[model samples]
Target: MLGTIIITIFILGPVGVLSQSAENNSISERIIGGHSAAEGQFPYQVSIRVNGKHECGGSIISSFWILTAAHCVARYPLGVLLVVVGTNHVKLGTPYGVAQVFVHEQYESQTKINDIGLIKLAGRINFNAKIKPIQLSTSLQPPGTSCVLSGWGFTNVQTQTIPDSLQYIGMRIVSVERCRAAISAAGLNMPVVDTQVCAFNAPGRGACNADSGGPLVCNGVQYGIVSWGNPCATGVPDVFTSVAANRKWIAIKSGV
Candidate 1:
């Protein structure tokens, strides 16, 4: 049951307003209530930059491929995007030019379904203790399962600026029914489909703007891609694109 909900998408990579559906909601960026990550702690984490700015978070699924939200790269062209890896600090990573982008064919900006996307780097990444690829999840984690989300997104939504150092927080997966109910209670008329997963822990702690396209790792496997949610972790469950649900599509597109 889809209803009209105000979706504040944290679209950090793109520089302009995204007109999704009739609402035409504004897009911003961040991660709320998180802490600084240690060096090499999240080796698969990466910063998706546009025009030399850190705009979105991504994961290194392969030496030549990165996985992120379709919204992060869907609206922009190839030349403007760059991927940086191998560092916890956003400014001190190895940069790679994008060669190709593969957004899900059925991605819908309004509904935020099938929000996965892939990036093929112009050159291969050199793996080290500080840089590596993450394994894709083959199954959906049950509700209440603990997971870690890492990114260089904004620590505060009001500031609307990304942090130089990577940030991470522990969150727990919630049932789709609970997610839908929470969104409805929050006055958002958006549907939480099976292709999407929801995670939440407390009211003030959750994914915010600029946290989009980041990885949700459970048991060391990447299971979700940060998609959309209430602004700055206002306790409303944060939604993500289920990597397990889109594994085949990812393999077909990137062969990773």
Candidate 2:
């Protein structure tokens, strides 16, 4: 009945990472209403740096590959992007140069469709207690299932600065039908395709600026990629790239 809703509501725009903080307070102002993660809590979490600063978050899917939103790296050259793993704090890890960057061939920058991308590390990442690859899910998770989203993004949209350590929050998946209804009620005219998943955003709980390209994990599996949503965790559902929908694309690009 609502098949057409997917064509009419919510095609997300480029979602930025948590903004860089002032010279001071760079590491303590992370995700909105979230808490700090312990070391190895999310071993696959990665910070995607550009020109030596944390610009976005990503997930390690294999020793030599990372999965992130294409919009995060589409504009930057390969030389400027560095993938850092094995650390919970943003600036504490060694930066590995990217050997190659692959944006999905069908990525639509205008609407954020097929927003996934991959990075081939210049050198293989060594796995340790604090660094490892996350498994990718091949099935769709039902709505209302709890998932964990971790990133180093802004805690407040108005402020637009990030925390020192990685932050995480538990969120629930919103049904596609309900998500479309909410966007329609909000008067936002965009598309929500099969490749996208929507996560519920309660007050003070949601991905904000600078949280893009991070991993959205469920049952310890990489199920979603942080894509876009209402600024500042407003009471609207945040959208992600459904990993299960694009698993083949990831496998081909990552060779994992």
Candidate 3:
């Protein structure tokens, strides 16, 4: 049925990857209606950069491991990717080299299912009040749970102007059925599988481009990874790869 729809649904990561329909629309980027994060408020948040540009967000899962969306690192080589941590401002953080990247073998770009990935840092991170690993959630929070999303993605989609500092917003977990209905309402025939969860608030308030791979933390536990969604908020639920669904794979891959 999605194939029957004329309008395209965009991925929320690196640009140039087209939707299943092969449309020319670019990837979604940023967080809408978010507040500027304070120093050390989100210590686990990291800016994932490619070729010296901020392209996605990630979370520190361990001293040596980072969790993000698979689409964020699938196409890029290890050398070009860098992780910046321990600061609210993207440019002010300390940079770390990436030793390796592990994308979920089952990741499907078209559907964005199993869209999780892990990055091993070249060196062990020194944890402090400003830098620490977030605990991966072992279970999904119930629907209507409160959550927070943080990133350094663009605040304005039209101008594509990314903020220099981190931004965050509060959101509520959406039921899978509600999420599916919302997507269907948007005219997309894509599936919102059990391995994924959804979050949303009001219109013009949700994850956007470049916010991909960021953590969707519920009650301080890292529960989801920003994967894809309706571009620029628009009231549709923002879908995320469920962390609990892939916890075993993550443990096997990163031992985190």
Candidate 4:
């Protein structure tokens, strides 16, 4: 039916991450609305600093495990990576501990598919007010629902990374059919794989590299994992790893 929508809507850029917050109220609103999370909800979400160098974000699904995109993992080797939890401050603070990291055996860069990996921490994460795990929904998220995403990534495109304070924005879920049509319209085939989901109405919101593997909390539940977004925050819809689709694999690995 609407298989050609994806091609036509290649990409229109999105606005900056509300860079207009100069007043105390606007700044406070940004803090509360964007990056603020209730204590211990998404505890597994942490800033992954490699060799104490670059900071790539990740999510902890288990006491000893973290899930993140393969692209982020491949940027460096395992031993050089260190996991830092409870990081709201960007440049200062201790980021937990890193024991070992394991990449998905099937991840391939050229395909930009199967982009998932896990990190095994040296020690069980200390459960605390700022450290909590988000619940992964085992079912596909209902379309048209409001979606919440957060990250330390930049507010602008030219920037390559996110700031210290985690920032976030709320968006709506795009229907599967609409998402497929969008891709098809772009001269790409409709995405029918169980691994992906498309969210809707992100006029000025999306992932900018630092948000990989973080939760897409919808309706008070974790629905999706950030995967990819080109020209992020624009017309190109952000793609995610459908939590429902990988339940079996996660269950096998995480026993959840």
Candidate 5:
């Protein structure tokens, strides 16, 4: 029997609550092997916050809809989660309350498949230089296609501290054959399915803790949602919710 594999769904860190206590300085920053991004470089990027701190990353699909990983908000109530958009800096973004949260009905925590989610903003976000909506990719990119990932995740996995500014990293999509081989080589027999998009983080490049729910954009079209991956950027292929395969779900949830 293929033994059970405890796939770690990166929730960024311990579940953050909607509290007013002093900020915890130990949460691992979300992105690894990325540089600082300009204020409006990724206009569709949004920070999913809890109690005024960046908890996970999300993408603005429309004025009122944001797409993210289901595991990011599956446990929280609809109204407690907040969406911060219109800025790159985490603390400087415009905060909007979430009116509803739609986690994919088929989401599986054990395998981390169907890990997509959507958030409806209480009010429409005003489009500006620092805020806009991105188009979801309807087709899959070939292996080795370059894509951009943006987030305020941890700068280094060992240190577990997030940066003061937003971060961006360029990554290449990994072939399913190679991805499965890599996982097997790591002593894991986990299957990499069509619904999951695998991308290379190299040895020092990729999304880390708290980056879940962020977008993987290829050629300016949102391609994937940061789902789960091996700890930090350890050259392991990171798994994402394949946006191309879930286009219908996104369209139904966001009407985009």
Candidate 6:
């Protein structure tokens, strides 16, 4: 658990927004590429949609709660915050539950800081192999440990349409010094806030706009939430609001 916690903290930290890139530009290519974020068995591997339209991905942290990006909440109205669970293929199936989306009181879409949100479901989910909450990490990520990221974002950055299957890739945590160097080079003042950590693609794969609000899951634990990217997993560094840094805040806010 300690090893995993260290790994996750290292892999996620700092700014991201909508993206268009060479990695994945279209939904068809991503689906054909064989990577998607909705696969696997976990009570919380969830999906959210607004107004009957799929908006982005997320995870269920509690039987009656779902967690995801703050930007996602800002992008959509409170109309229908659909929380889908289990069954990877989102196209065909019954969802575990439906919920109302609520953004963190301090969540600011413009700043992309404290980018956290929750969904209160109308009913509780029955835990099962295919449906279970992912383990959350309270341990901070140590630089360089590898962690895994999964999502249904475009195969690359420029593509449209979300992939039908889930995609996953492994990455290493970026040291604070390095993550800061990357951010500084971009001309933005490095965040002084201590509760954040950073990560990027090990070499090839990366995250994009479609991947925002996703989980930076590692070591069987969810250590960070996808918040922002400067270059959208490209040249500019990406950032995540470190979970270990805000575990107590989340628990208290969500009443977990």
Backbone clash count for every predicted candidate, in the order shown? 7, 13, 6, 18, 6, 38
lDDT of 5: 0.73
- Better structure of 3 and 4 per lDDT: 3
Give TM-scores for every candidate, taking all chains together and pairing residue i with residue i: 0.90, 0.87, 0.91, 0.77, 0.88, 0.78
Candidate 5: misplaced stretches above 4 Å? 1-29
Looking at candidate 2, what is the lDDT of residue 226?
Answer: 77
> Once model 4 is optimally superposed onto the true structure by TM-score, how far is the C-alpha of residue 104 displaced, in angstroms?
3.1
| Top candidate (TM-score) | 3
TM-score computed on alpha carbons, candidate 1? 0.90
- Count of backbone collisions within predicted model 4: 18
Ranking by lDDT: 3, 1, 5, 2, 6, 4
Q: Model 6 over residues 120-154: C-alpha lDDT tens digits?
A: 78888887777778777889878776776666555
- List candidate 6 segments past 4 Å from native: 1-43, 96-99, 186-192
Model 3 regions more than 4 Å off: 1-8, 11-27
Per-candidate Cα RMSD to the true structure, in Å, reads 6.3, 7.9, 5.9, 8.6, 8.3, 7.2
Q: Could you tell me how far off, in angstroms, the CA of residue 185 lies in candidate 1 after the best superposition?
A: 0.4
Model 3 lDDT, residue 182, Cα: 70
Alpha carbon deviation, residue 165, candidate 2 (Å): 1.1
Evaluate all candidate structures by whole-model CA lDDT and list the values in order: 0.77, 0.72, 0.78, 0.54, 0.73, 0.56
- So what's the TM-score on candidate 6? 0.78
Error of model 1, residue 201, in angstroms: 1.9
**Model 1 clashing residue pairs (backbone):** 3-189, 4-189, 5-189, 29-209, 29-210, 30-209, 30-210
Question: Which 10-residue window in model 3 sums to the lowest lDDT?
Answer: 1-10
